[model samples]
Target: MAVQASPQTLAPFLIEPRFVPRVWGFDDLRPWFDWSRFEKGREAGDPLGEVWLTGDDCHIATGPYSGKILADVIAQEPRAILGPVAPRVESPLLIKVIFAREKLSVQVHPDDKLAQKYGDPRGKTECWYALDSQPDAQVAAGLKPGVTMDQVRAGIQNGTLEDSLNVLPVERGDMIFVDAGTVHAIWPGSILLETQQNCALTYRMYDYGRPRELHIEKSLEATRLTTRAGKVLPVSRPDRTILVDVEYFRVERLPVRSQRSSASLAASDEPGPGLSYLFAAAGSARLTGEGFEPIEIPARGLVCVPAVGSAFVLEDLGGLDLVRMSPRWPAAI
Candidate 1:
């Protein structure tokens, strides 16, 4: 039997959003996503903490590729879709919008070495871009300057692990890069855009008396006792800013100003030659390429741009704020 190939297009395709419920979730997800669009018939108190924008299971919402899973599309057209930097057949980066109403568990993730040893595919190194924050909102990242492994263990045993953490206040537009093996937690009243390696192997160290299981031995083995902190730095460029450049992925903030035409917007910057996830953070825009029909990307929506040589443009309606995330083969320090 002659097998047929799935259709391919260089144009961007929208991805359906997946809401994940959590115990520490918040009911409201605004500016980032309008929960009312998808949760119309649901109950009022279904607190959703994370909105998975891009995953293997995320399906295409429109165009000829509608209803097709992202993983399948990648598998069917690996070279055409993934371009020259196709790390694997599957997408290497995971994008999500996290809303924390209450404190998350103090956890640590293994590095690549430990992940491989523990029979996991990959480790998690995540970066957070704060979209919104309430007054006094804070996040605990890394251990205190002088905290040692012995102290960490003692604090965990004595229910004082938080005391050994360095908590810092956060606000909108702040960026934080969390390296693998760093002990961290996201405090209450925060909405963040998180980009991480495609892995979910979390080793919980402490959960603040929650009933969930704790991985003391495993977390301790993965935890780095040395002092580490994520600095809140401003991005250099307004048109396109490289927010995070690490081994796993590279996240850039691209603000498409209100342009007259697609040609003018495309002239703003050169699109990289690889698979990139385009997330509409604020306003709506029209995604147009050479031959494919234009696609509308509403606020809080996500679109996948295939690896094509021809650049695409986002015709900004008002002001379109987008975050572009792509996988990097070798770690870019």
Candidate 2:
């Protein structure tokens, strides 16, 4: 199969913000959803609202595209994005724009080896895109300078774990890349877009002194304890584009520019041989492929194209910015 953009379709999605609980109440959407609530809470000023633009919240779609479950889809198409069939299902990536109403638990993810060693079904490697931030919004990226693994483990047990983690304040548009084994957390009052491998393995180090359950022994085994080192700072080219790399995904940001936009189709910009999913993050753009409709993906709307066919043209229809994501190598993934 070739890489091509076919008309995209939408799967069902839940208003995933944590505070208010309603599986997916349309009435509660205004307050429950964070970034792009239509009337109440925070408005996601874009056309597709926040959910549709980044279908990370969308649950299930079609063959090999699994939502809420990774094993099943990978079983159907191992090479689709999770990689060549061999062991268990490996989702190439997972995406989510987190609205942290409260601090997230300090956590670490295992790599493939550790996951298998612990008899875990999957591991995690992910990144973040800051869409909104509060004055005190911060992320625990790495360990504090000069902290050692032995010190980290002891700190967790002693209740001083926060002191051992690197706390970095974040602003809107900031990007952070997290490889496996990195101890990290997204603080409350921030909205972020997260991209990671389709795995659910997370070892919570601490949950804010709150009596939340702790994944202690497993976390101990999963924690890398290596001093936080070599964390990358967010960088945008002279063109204001940012690229962040996680173990499973490579994501790029293109600020909406002209009424007309053009770029060569590159796998590095996407994830696998599968077609890229384009969402009008902040603007209105029309995508015209060789044989498809000149479909318009408004801000908050999404479109998925298969990895085949010729390059298409994207035209920004004023007051619009867009985010386009695909595999770095569609065939190889």
List clashing residue pairs in candidate 1.
247-331
Best by lDDT: 1
* Model 2 regions more than 4 Å off: 1-91, 209-211, 227-242, 255-263, 267-275, 290-294, 309-311, 328-333
lDDT, candidates in the order shown: 0.76, 0.55
lDDT of 2 by residue, 61-151 (tens): 2222434333343344344332322223333455555555556788888877788887865567677777677888888887766888777
User: Which stretches of model 1 miss by more than 4 angstroms?
Assistant: 1-9, 28-32, 39-46, 227-229, 260-272, 331-333
**Residue 35 deviation, candidate 2, in Å?**
11
